[model samples]
Target: MDKRSLTQLTERFRESEKRTEILRQELAAAIRQAAADDVPQKDICEATGYTRQQIRRIVLAGETETAAQP
Candidate 1:
C-alpha cells in the first residue's frame, strides 16, 4: 500500500478506537447500574459475555470514573 493510504488507514483506525472506548465506557456505566438494581451477576455475565471478575472490575472502574467527575 502507498504511504498516503497507510496514513489514512491509521487515522481511521485511531478514530474507530476512540469511538470504541466511548461505547465501552457507556457499557460499563450500564453494567454498574444493573448491578445496583439487584440484577444477578451471573445473569449479567451471561448477557454481556463477561466473567464475574471482569464485571466487578468494570463496575469498580466505572464507579471510580464517575466519582472523579465534577
Candidate 2:
C-alpha cells in the first residue's frame, strides 16, 4: 500500500480509538447514574449486556474518578 493510504488508515484507526474511549466514559457515567437512581444490578446487567461484576467495576471506577476530581 502507498504511504499516504497507510497514514490515512492509521489516522482513522486512532480516531476510532478516541471515540471508543468517549463512549466508554459515557457508559460508565450512565451506569453510575442508574445505580444512584436505585436501579437494580440485574436490570443494569440486562440493559447493558454486561455481567454483574463488569457493571460493578464500572460503577466503582466512575465513583473513584469522580471523588478524585475535587
Candidate 3:
C-alpha cells in the first residue's frame, strides 16, 4: 500500500527475474557441454549441482536436438 513497500517489491521482482535468466543460461550451457562431452547424466548432475532427473531431462533434450539436425 505504501510507496516504500511498492519499491521494495519491485526490486525483489527484478532480482528474481535476473536470477531466473542466469539460471536458464547456466542450464543451457550445462546441457550443451554435457552433450558435447558425452558425459553421463550422473556426472553432469554432480558437476552442475542439478538433480539426476534434471540432468536426464537436459540430456534427453540435447539428444532430440541432435536427432533433428540434418
Candidate 4:
C-alpha cells in the first residue's frame, strides 16, 4: 500500500484496538465483581479465558485505574 493508505489503515487499526481495550477493561471489572461475590478463581479463569494470575492483575489494574479517576 501507498504511504497515505498505510497511514489511514494504521490509524483505523489503532482506533479499533482502543475500542477493544475498553471492552477488555469492562470485562475485567465484571470479573472482579464476580470474584468479590465468592466466585472461585479457577472458575473465573475458565470462564474468562484468562489465567488466574492474569485475572488478578486485571482486577488490580482495573481497581488502580478506577481509583486514579476523579
List, residue by residue over 23-64, the lDDT tens digit for candidate 2.
Answer: 988998999999999999999999999999999898898888
Clashing pairs in 4: none
Model 4 RMSD, rounded to 1 decimal: 2.5
How much lDDT does candidate 2 score? 0.94
Off by over 4 Å in 3: 65-70
Cα lDDT for residue 50, candidate 3: 78
lDDT of 3 at 68: 100
Instruction: Report the lDDT tens digits of candidate 3 across residue range 1-70.
Output: 9999999999999999999999996787777786688887767777778788777777678778879999
Tens digits of lDDT, candidate 4, 3-69: 9999999999999999999998789889989977989999998898889889899778878888999
**Alpha-carbon RMSD, each predicted model:** 1.7, 1.2, 3.1, 2.5
Error of 2 at 6 (Å): 0.6
**TM-score, per-candidate, Cα-based:** 0.85, 0.89, 0.56, 0.73
Model 4 residue runs over 4 Å out of place are 62-70
Model 3: residue 33 alpha-carbon error in angstroms: 1.3
Clashes of 2: 0
Per-candidate Cα lDDT values, in order, are 0.94, 0.94, 0.81, 0.89
